[model samples]
Target: MSLNGPRGSAWAMTERTARDVDRAKHHFSVGPSAMRWDGETLVIDIAEVSSPLPYKVRGTIRVRPEMIGSTAFSLDPEGRHRWHPVAPRAHVEVSMTDPGLRWSGAGYFDSNFGDEALEDGFNDWHWSRAHLRNDVAVLYEGKRRDGTPFDLALRLDRMGNWHDIEQPAPVRLPRSAWMIERLTRADRGFIPRVAKTWVDAPFYARSKLSTRLFGENVEAVHESLSLNRFRSTIVQGMLPFRMPRAIWR
Candidate 1:
């Protein structure tokens, strides 16, 4: 989960085992983090935290789908790797009691799952989502472990229709403070600039950018991930500090 605004930006992530996961239709709870569907509202309760956050975070973020288009994109011909964006344009209203955080804005949700590990199938990937008027556009580009490249551009409309737009030209943004390269696709006339860096790690980076897409200036949530670096022993050694798991009897 992430909180981004004028003041600052903060992000939290947790990794849990299958044993801790409770799953059902429109209902998911893993340890202290849970999300449930209440009619048209999606409630998220996040208590699992690692460092710097003084209080546990719990919030009800309403998700109203403006577009219903969705598909599971197979990253590998063997169907071992796939991605799905269930909600492309979701109207989100966020409210947190502790520490008093409240905001209402647009949001996006997607799921990526695969039988094989990420490094086993991907070298790296760059993903970004831009909210357009009455629609949402998502761009995905990456290279497979075999050095083959993949790209997709999808736009979902309020009428539940999907359009495959022409892939925009690639634009290289400035490197992160952590020295990781960042790139995103945009119109040839537009330049994407990272406005804020929420998390800049050895192998992963998440940032917010202001870019022009589909003829509109939009603020987008962008992420760059390097599975090759993540597989390194040095990066693996740093995981525990950000995502601390506990043992239970």
Candidate 2:
């Protein structure tokens, strides 16, 4: 779990064994946090202590899907990886006690499934999502381990319909503070700018982008992942400091 805001920042990634995990038709849990789907909304309960800081992070996030997605897109040619935008358009309600914050706004929920390790599948990837007037535009592009490239552009409407669209030209954004390469897509002749960077690590970067998508000016949440850097020994050695492991008794 991670929270970044003006109040403060907190991060907790506790690794646990299989004995600490629970799953059912509509619920999944690990350690002290869990996510359950009610009839209309997905509720997430978080109880965690930040790593390296030990600050409490307790919150409830409710995501109400305006429309549920029905399809999953393959990220690799051999069907080794797949991406599903479960709730491309949604309303989010956040209430946090440890930070004493409350807010609501447009939100999105998605999941990725893979048959093998991520580094074995691809080198890196860039993804972004923008909420248009009555639709959501998502762009995904990446390079495979075999030196092949794949990309997807889709527009999901408020009525649970998906339409394939032409991908926009790639735009190079300023590198992150960690010097990680960042990229996003925007309409022709329009340049995208990074409004805020949320997470900047050795192997990953997440930012808020001001860009034009589908001919509309919008602010998009963008992320870039470098599997090459992630599989390096230096980054591997640094993981223990950020993600503490514990056996749930």
Candidate 3:
């Protein structure tokens, strides 16, 4: 399933496997999130998942070495249903040591999390108003040197009392940042000596939104989404929270 969607109104469990992180060691590795609405204040929950059991192949147990989680968001009545998922309510925690890495943040997701979740096909974009809506997210758009668009979605829910903030998300560094050095194009089979990555989610009017970046290993693409040009960037920003430095190496 894709990690992004636009909730006009809107909307996770796995077991012990090899691909799964060690429950005793790095079990808190989760995210690539999503967003939706619960009632008013927008409830978003992200999990640090770890299951090194391997899930894609048919070798009894196979899972990809990627992080997992989801985002929960509502819609902005002022924006007239311009669903958009932004920062979490607060900054989640991500850390990296010499042997372990963990990411503790919030987003939107249901079940089965891994790297395969960001592939070309085999994804489900969803939303919620009365019931869960299976949506077709417009992804694969950004300018990360190559063409690695980060597949994500968003939604603005009824602000209720705290209607001042459009997408109330708490931007946090990925746990990966704790262990890995400066991100380089080589991180994405491209360049080298990345310098560093910078982020700032400039939220303009509950509807207009965009993310900019400078460095390497990142990709951007602007694709089609219900007659809208949804642009995005893909970077290594999900480790500083749930992963330890040990696991990062």
TM-score of every model? 0.89, 0.96, 0.20
Q: What digit string (tens of lDDT, one per residue) describes model 3 on residues 1-249? A: 112223211101232334544223222332322233433223323333332422221101112211221342222212222223232122343332311334554322222233221222221121111101221111211122123222233322323111221221212222223222111111122322212223212110011112222221222222111111112221224222322334453
Task: Report the error of model 2 at residue 156, Å.
Answer: 0.7
Is candidate 2 or 3 superior in TM-score? 2
User: Which model scores highest in TM-score?
Assistant: 2
Residue 39 lDDT (model 2): 89
CA error at residue 26 for candidate 2, angstroms: 1.9
Model 2 TM: 0.96
lDDT at 207, model 3: 16
After best superposition, candidate 2 residue 83: deviation in angstroms? 0.8
Better of 1 and 2 by TM-score: 2
Q: In what order do the candidates fall by TM-score, top score first?
A: 2, 1, 3
Return the clash pairs for model 2, or none: none
